[model samples]
Target: MADPTPLSVFDDLRAESDELDDAVAELGPERWALQTPASGWTVAHQIAHLAWTDHSALLAVTDEDGFRELVEKALAAPDSFVDEGAEEGARMPPAELLARWREGRTALDQALRAAPPGARIPWYGPPMSAASMATARLMETWAHGLDVADALGVTRPPTDRLRHIARLGFRTRDFAHVVHQVPVPADPFRVELAGPSGELWVFGPEDAPQRVTGPALDFCLLVTQRANRADLALRAEGPDADRWLDIAQAFAGPPGTGRPAKGDAR
Candidate 1:
């Protein structure tokens, strides 16, 4: 794998956000109220959450104290925040919802551009650099957008920018270890990803004997827990290979309960 380029990472984020905007705009009002594959979240709820998150990201970039206050506010808000947001959103015509989404996204874009290079921003979990925060926001939008598309039976095209999201999954290998209380292997392993666009993204040493490979979207979905790992064609070789794949995660916070492996469901 070549050295990970920062410029490429930024480009990936830009592309991912743009694609998500297009997908969200394409959904009709009926589809916006439709239930998504994610438990209890409708398409409107998804967009609302994304909008709320962008607001949170802005706070992270500009005001850490305010960000914490907002999280507390969300927690203190009505237990039916998601339902309320969805219902309110459902009442809006498609154009209105799309307009709100665009407005929030524009603010997020401005926040990303204005943030200092090394700024450490508060996140839903640990603090992260401005770049990492932007990356996280992009990943969430794309991953949730996938849920909306799946609910609507619309196929989203692959984008080169997914590589940015994939890189977050790669970096989270360490977080996964900490959450699972499993020690990561000190020995470096090669990571080669075939993205949704059929482009190969590699990290670690090119010649490293151990490797992880599969469809990029599947890999992203698995790491995000949007899809079961077994549904993906991921393969690992070497002593600790299987263990690493077992707990792969892309997001911060406590480790999630991964979906059951194929044929293992009750």
Candidate 2:
């Protein structure tokens, strides 16, 4: 399949958010306060973080200076800023929190659509095209939605939408090494993922000696650090590739203190 267009990714973002909304829309205050697998974050915190990030994305797309201020705040409180954002939004009544998320995400969709073709948008990390921004948002929604689903003792079936994240996980190979203070491999590693729909998604040289392969769902979970690698079904066929699995993270930040392996907590 061809790369997803900006409009298509924007559509996917809407769908992902809507699906999450369906999960949480009718929750009572008690349900909203239920703790999720994300350490201190509650169900409300998951949605609030999404809403807060959506609003931040909107500012980045529309107001570079404003986004810079947010970046400054993040720099000043690198460890606590993300939690702070989620906490602020989570404090609102559930109904208001939901409304804010809906409004902010809808506005972001509009802004992305109106953006001039090929224009770059400012971001917490590097500037990105509208399509990349939409894809990043979709990836986050799916990951956090998983936390919400787990909190509710439910499951969310994987979707081909994770292809974007899988692609990102592969593309960020060097980034993963860099963040871990490891030198990037000189040769590229091949990656092959089976999409949720069973479509083959391939990246890198077909004949590369180093390779990573897995269900797209597992790769997405691994790179997002939502599930511990030991609990996932991914495989790495080279030393560097193996190390990539150990530290892969698609989202920009300090290394995530990823989830513990199943049944092993200290």
lDDT values of the candidates?
0.74, 0.92
TM-score of each: 0.84, 0.98
**Model 2, backbone clash pairs (residues 3+ apart or across chains), number:** 0
Candidate 2: stretches off by over 4 Å: none
lDDT of 1: 0.74
- Where is the poorest 10-residue window by lDDT in model 1? 1-10
Q: Pick the candidate with the highest TM-score.
A: 2
RMSD of each: 3.3, 1.0
Q: Give the per-residue lDDT digits (tens) of candidate 1, residues 154-230.
A: 88876766777788887887788888899877777777888665668887788887778777777787778877777
Q: Report residue 18 deviation for candidate 2 (angstroms).
A: 0.5
Task: Write the residue-wise lDDT of candidate 2 on 120-221 in tens digits.
Answer: 998877889998999889989999999999999999998888888888888888888888888899999999989988899999999999999989999999
Top candidate when judged by lDDT against the true structure: 2
Q: Clash number for every model?
A: 0, 0
